[model samples]
Target: MDLTLGAVLRRGLLAGLAAGVAAALVALFVVEPVIRDALVVEEARAAAEPAGAHEEELVTRTTQVIGGMLAAVVVALCLAVVLAVVFAAVRHRLPGGTDFGRLGALAAYGFVTVALLPGVKYPANPPAVGDPDTVTTRTLQYFSLIAAAIAVTWLAFAVRNALRRRDWPAPRAVVVSTIAAVTGYVLLLVLWPANPDPIPADIASLLWRFRLASLAELAALWGTLGLTMGLLLTTRRTPATPATAAT
Candidate 1:
């Protein structure tokens, strides 16, 4: 039950390792297949177009798309490492057998990371698409948002056990994680130029990109959370076997 700096560091490192492995596996098996299928469909559509459209143009577009996807993947991996460390460190400061509380804290942390930050940065609009014809873009945007929400949820549960036992002040981990995530997001947005031709003309387009970025961030946080929780839960003491009745 002793919460020390060394314990926190050890837990964070272990969590980050586990999260990185899990995120990599998921990217290879699940996310890759889906991305590949989308690319194939896009290729087919491009192929069916009239001749003299310049196949090289299509190739260039495809390359850009792939590059963006890969960049997103790398970002996700990094996020996982960071989140794992943060969650592990926070959990280490809390008391033992506090899984439920840990989860609650994580969920709060996620909300702060995803919803609160964006709400602060951008104005809210009616959650509706401006153009019905841009369904593909809208769908991708929503998909990214859902993925982000799921990742946050996963992180919340991972830390639930640890949070239950701690007397740490409310919103500490959540606030810190949110600030870190937002700061990182702003830096990336500023340092990296915007796409010359962004899809969708209005709020929907912005939301879509926001969703994608959130998904990456959430993945990183959850990956770390999973690793830390797994370690704590597995290494904790187990109850002794019951005494045998007289034969």
Candidate 2:
């Protein structure tokens, strides 16, 4: 099987779509209800406040659930595609050469960089969890952290490459890169402004559960997609299949 870029992309897209289906199923059956329950609590809190609160429902609950499922499927597929490209691009640079173990390690790295790193700073919240006035600011800060994480990771790669060119040992290169990335990450967290809106004590548990479920959502999507892509890419398949191409 030729491991051309197009062939890798085809395999990635297929795997990503499969992952999307799995993620959507989990979100629909498990995560969505937890979110809905949190929303209910939020709504009750609002209702108990001053009269004439905004009560219009432009989007119905049925519609929200359906739309959420669809969005999850689409987002999962997209993330899978990106992960596939990243995997293919970086596999050769790493010590292992297209081995399953290396592939799994890369997947874990992706989750840490793409999901967990930024997630720790700007944890996911229920619909009404944060202050409505600070939505834009909060969103900007969250994405800024994501961008910083990505940039730092790239810089670490540059550090490793530079070290490798200078006859540095593999372990030394890895250690330096890890230190640089971690140091940069910590500095960014310190410099970034924190979210001041405090979570109410009563609903803190529910919020925690919602955030956990949110992280689990990404973990499931990426884990499934990465593993599936790795397996499909490593295994032999017919040339007629998208997993392969013309020799």
Candidate 3:
């Protein structure tokens, strides 16, 4: 398609930034309120205890809206940059290079590695959930899972490449690699510590809703970015007809 690296990065980053904005909108309008409600419930339960410094000045509705939106944009921008780099890195590894199929696969890979796998190990919790003291520990666990997921993906690629070199059938190599990645992921899920903070049954519904919202938000971001990149690439690859070229 004669696309340069700079063009790819520029387009990918723009798409990602746009996707992040869209995701933040969903979070601000849909997810944050539910989380806020959940926090209220928590606050009532802890009303009697002397408020710790961390607990003081709970995230107000206004701050939630403003902060959530800003955070979403910033996070999306950063995430998009990284995803763009990853897309470039894996472009050659993908069959047929940077086609729509490759774009879709990259998006799916990003979602799985960045969101699903890590979330499975440490799903997003409501604001009021978890021990404040363990914030550092929990953060490490979550990021560690992310790193592990990336490692597992890299390992799958390595396995596939090794098998391919050994004259294994393409289909067989893919299957074996898929199985290896899944097995590694499952093991990570089991070995990792999930959210252990007990939630009452009543708040379960809210928590469930919040988690779903969180997933939807991220899915939306990746979906937008993927679709945008696909469109951009397709447009770029389109041939100019005689009439169009003359014009």
Candidate 4:
């Protein structure tokens, strides 16, 4: 029943592996095709350029594809480690009917804070869409918004906890917290800088598909990570001796 760091981390790593695989599958089957379609636009633009004007390709598509898959695994592993550490620290405080529910809630929250909010503000774009000149500006805006979103969410949680400590009704506390969080998010959305790059008509049409595919990949990673972590922690295992198990 001891929620030891080692035990939790071990489960987390395995969950991360499963999540990476699931995300990679989504990336390969869903996102990649949309990327390929966008790349066609890039290629056409390049072919239209005067000879020696287009940038030279340093990496082949095959290498990029493989590398992208590897990157997904690496990113998933990092996120899983963070999840494990956070769970170990705050699992008892997390609201849920069961451990599975707690972990699931955490995973869903992680997705919104880490992926959804930032993505909504600055949606993903395939190659040939964004302007190279504005990359730095866009990157800064994207990360800044993510940081702000996380801060807002954390503050909301703290407010809810404070209310609970004051003996406020749980439902009232949650409702108040939710309203505050939504207001904060709306303010952030209105204040944050918009993407500087103008999407070409062709790229704009493809943007919806690319962003949806990206969301699918992200959801797959977080959802699988949660599900796998829960199974690892909760699935009953038979012991030779009567070793006690903890939920």
Candidate 5:
């Protein structure tokens, strides 16, 4: 079968849409709730009070936060799907050069998702130490692990794209992009600090403040990955002309 740019972009959009929806569903219904429950349990334990004392309050608050977050994620996913479909249609209609429209759609989706990260409530666990330094360290460590996982996932996609194209000449672009993304994330984590307060006590307030920073970091990673892949896939040598070939 002939491989057209339109077809390629359509596939990419479909893949992205599917993945985005899956992630949203899991994050909304499963992961967030589990984390919230764990956080509540931890909070209750740390308080050295009966869980029943604050069970109702905890449930109500967590439910409200999780509900709002789920709604936001659903909205974002819908927007992403709509944008992707539009991009695919446009690319199909205007078949000329490789479609960067799909890349733009992906970037937009990623941006929206990242933007919501600030609203994500980290479960409140008792601070291991009363000192702010320990809290800071723990926060950094957790965020670092999360950032690393995100970076690794992006790199995996890059590698998969390269493999699909059978253009393993040297993944310099991928390597460079990955390094830049990781660096940006690390810098953001260190320079832009969030409050050391764990969970419900600090979660809601910090969500808005730190959300943008996290989004920026995620945007850097997404931009790096998308741009690198776009560059590699779109830039290719032209076919030799008859005169040049004869020589």
Candidate 6:
């Protein structure tokens, strides 16, 4: 099968559709409920405040729910576009025996660098949990951690490649690189500033559930993207379908 820019994009869009739908469903069913629970706490808090102190919402809840689902798809598609282009560039060099394996590895790398590590450092909160004044500080911290994680990943892979180029054994290269990555991540986690806004203890359980659900939705996106693309590739390789295209 061809791994051309066009072909990979076509495949990626299809896979992304599957991924987006999966994530959207998770957001709607799992995360949304948690969000509603948080909103209830928020409403109660607002009720306790002086009248007219709280701002009225311009958008209705139903609209926001539908919009959230749509946003998930848009984000997933955008991320998939990035994945498609990146896979095309690094397809040959990725450490995998097959294209599927390579794509899966890339997706896993993305999940770690782009989603998991950063999320662990700064878990998502419900709309009402944080101090509004610290929004700028929190945003900067979150993106900074994401950048740090990606940099660490790149350096780790670079070190691994350097070792391989120096005639180091594959296992040794992998082990050394893995150690570097773990150490770098640990340092970053320790050094990066914690979320400035404290989690509200009143709704701690709801917050925990919401964070977990958010992670689950993200995991579903990447997992589906990888698996769907792999299945598509596998289908093309079956005996029933003769595939002969440039890779």
**TM-score winner, 2 or 5:** 2
Model 5 agreement with the true structure over 1-247: per-residue lDDT tens digits: 1235554455444444444444445455544544555565558566897555543454575676567455544554454455445444444332123545445534543443343232232323222213455766756645664565455435544553555357543355446544655554455445544646444553454333334433433344345434543443344333454223311
Residue runs of model 2 more than 4 Å from their true location after superposition: 99-102, 167-172, 238-247
Worst 10 residues of 3 by lDDT: 238-247
Model 6 Cα lDDT, one tens digit per residue, 1-247: 4546777888888999999999999999999999998888889989999999898799999999999999989898988888888888888766655788878878888888888988788898888988989999988998999899989988987888899899998789888988998899889999999998877787878888989999999999999988887667555534545556633
Report per-prediction Cα RMSD to one decimal. 11.8, 4.0, 4.2, 2.5, 12.4, 2.8
> Which residue segments of model 3 deviate by more than 4 Å?
50-55, 58-60, 96-98, 166-169, 200-202, 237-247
Better of 4 and 5 by lDDT: 4
lDDT (10s digit) by residue, model 3, range 1-247: 3446776788788887888889988988788888779878877878767767234567677886888888877887787777677767767666433457677777777788889887667777787777878888888888998898899988987898889889998789889988998998998899888765565677788878888889888888888888887667656644454323311
The better candidate by lDDT, 2 or 4, is: 4
Give a tens-digit lDDT track for model 2, residues 59-169: 998899889888988997788778778867876665443546556766776777778877788778888778988888888888888887788877877788789889898
Shift in Å, residue 84, candidate 6:
1.0
TM-score, each model?
A: 0.39, 0.86, 0.85, 0.92, 0.34, 0.92
The Cα local distance difference test for each model comes to 0.48, 0.78, 0.78, 0.86, 0.46, 0.86
Query: What TM-score does candidate 5 reach?
Result: 0.34
lDDT of model 2 at residue 216? Answer: 81
Pairs in steric clash, model 3: none
For model 3 the local lDDT of residue 165 reads: 88
- Candidate 4 lDDT, 154-238, residue by residue in tens: 8877788889899998789888988988888889989998999886775667999999999999999999999999888776353
Q: Can you give the lDDT of residue 51 in candidate 3?
A: 64
lDDT of 6 at 190: 95
TM-score result, candidate 6:
0.92
Give the per-residue lDDT of model 1 (tens digit) for 1-247.
Answer: 4444455455545554555555555544445544554445456656788876534554564575455455645654454445445556666443233644553355345545554434333322222323446556645544455355445444543443334346434455445444554455455334432223334443454454445544544454464555455456446553475324411
Give candidate 4 misplaced runs (Cα > 4 Å): 236-247
